[model samples]
Target: MAVLETPGAAGEPEIEVQIRGLMLDPVTNMPIVVLKEVGSDVVLPIWVGVFEANAIALELEKTETPRPMTHDLLRNLAKGLNATVRKVVVSDLRADTFFASIWMEQGGETVVIDARPSDAIALALRWDCPIYVSSKVMRHTRQNNAETAANVGADDLKRWLENLNEDDTGQYKM
Candidate 1:
C-alpha cells in the first residue's frame, strides 16, 4: 500500500491519472490500458488482455452485455454484500510486473485484495472508481513504454490510428 499525497515531495503537482482510451500493442496484439492525466499529454501504457479490454470498452461506450462478465460478477457480489469499491491501487512494479489491489468496504469492514493492475483496472471502470499507481509502477511503465514504442513500425501506427477512428475494437495482431 503506497500513499500518494497530492502535494508531491518535489513541489510538483501530483499527476492525476484517468483512463485515456483502449489500444492494442502493434507487436503482441495484446490489449492495453491508456492512462493519462486530464489536461496533460503524458500517457502511461499498461498491457492487458483482449477479453479484459473488451469488458472495459463496453463500460466506456456505455453498452450493456446480455450476460454478465467475470468482472461484472465480482461487482455484483460486492454489491450484494453491501460493499462499495473505493479505489484500485497499483501498489508495486518489479521486473515488468505491476501489482494492484482492490479496496472495498463490506458491511463496514474495509478489505484490500491483491490483483493484477490489468484486472483491477477492468473492475475499476465498472465501479466508477479511481486508480492509483505507486511511484515505482509509474517509473516501470515509463521504461517499458520507451522500449515498446521504439520497436513499433510505421505501418502499425498508421493502422492503429485508422482502427481508432473506425472503432473496429479488435486487438491489433503484432
Candidate 2:
C-alpha cells in the first residue's frame, strides 16, 4: 500500500483507489476518469484531455496498436533501465488541477517523478502497480466542487458524478 503524508494533517493516509470507469462529461463532453476508493463507495472524477483519455482508454480496454504508444515506450524505458514502478499517487489538487507522482525504484534508490494524473494513471495500468490518492486531494476536490456548485448552480453535475453507474459510463469512444 502506498501512503502520502499530508503537511498539516500529519499521518494522514493516502487512499488506495482503482479506475472505476472512463466516461464523457455530460456537460462538457470531455473525458473523465472515475476512481473509486478500494473497498469503499468514495469516488473521485478527474477531467482529462482527449489524447490522455484515449491513452487511458486504450490501456483499459487492452487495445493493441501497431506501434508502441507513449506510455508503452515509458514502460519499456523503465524496464530497460532496471527500474520498477512502485506506485503512482494523485498527490494534490490546486487551482482546479490535479497533480501526480510516479514512484520508481532502481537498484537501492527510489525516484519520484512529477506527472499529470492521467499520464501517471496510464503508466500505473501498464506497470500493474498500485494507485493512491492523497486524502487532502479528496478533501480539496469536495470543497472545490461544493464551492463551484454554490456559485454556478452545478449541484446537478455533482449529483450526476456521485451517482454514476456502469450504464452511465457506457463505452469510451476514441
Candidate 3:
C-alpha cells in the first residue's frame, strides 16, 4: 500500500496513488482502503478495523454522523491544543505489519506521535489532514507486490469489477 499524502502531507509528497475504493469484508465487517496509482493501473488493498474504517468512509462519502466520533474528538483536541495534524507518516512495514506517526505542529514546533498506520489514516481522514508514508515503507510494500498480485488473480479482479455495476464517480460511496 502507498503512504497517504496530498499537497499538504509534507513538503509535497509525490502523489503517486489515489484512494480508488473501499471494500467491506463479509466476514470481518471491516473496510479495506484501496489505492490506485496515478497513471499506471495498479491497486493496493489495506484492511482496517471497523471503527477506523467508518471514520475514513464517512469522510469519503461526505456524510456527517449524528455525533462526533473518536477521530473527530482527536481532531478537536488537536485544535484545542493549538496543534494541527501536519501529516501522517507510514514509517514501517515488517512481517506485513505497518507502523506510522502523526506529525503535528504547535507553537512553531513539530511533534511526531507514534501510531498504527490504520489509526493514523483514520484520524487523518477526520481531521482533513494529509497522509505520508516514507519512501522506505513504499519500497518494502513493493517487495510484497508480486505476492499481492499472485493472490488477487485476474479472475478475482474481473469478479470484483463486475460486482461494481455502477459509475466510477468521484464520490467514494464506500
| TM-score for each candidate, following the candidate numbering | 0.73, 0.87, 0.72
Worst 10 residues of 3 by lDDT: 161-170
lDDT of 1 by residue, 84-156 (tens): 9988876776676767778888888879899987788878988998877666555665675556656875445
Candidate 3's residue-wise lDDT over 1-174, tens digit each?
332444332343433445666677545756767655455454445677777666777877778889877777888899999998877766666787777778898999989898876678778777776655566655555556655546886556434522442244224455
What is each predicted model's overall lDDT from 0 to 1? 0.68, 0.84, 0.65
Would you list the rank order by lDDT, best first?
2, 1, 3
- Give stretches of model 1 more than 4 Å off: 1-15, 143-174
Residue 170, candidate 3: Cα error in Å is 11
Q: Using alpha carbons, what is the TM-score of model 3?
A: 0.72
Displacement of the residue 95 alpha carbon in candidate 2, Å: 1.1
1 or 3: which has the higher lDDT?
Answer: 1
Off by over 4 Å in 2: 1-12, 148-155, 172-174
Compute the lDDT for candidate 2.
Answer: 0.84
Candidate 1 minimal-lDDT segment of 10 residues: 165-174
Clashing pairs for model 2 are none
Candidate 1 residue-wise lDDT at 111? 90
Assess candidate 1 and give its TM-score to the true structure: 0.73
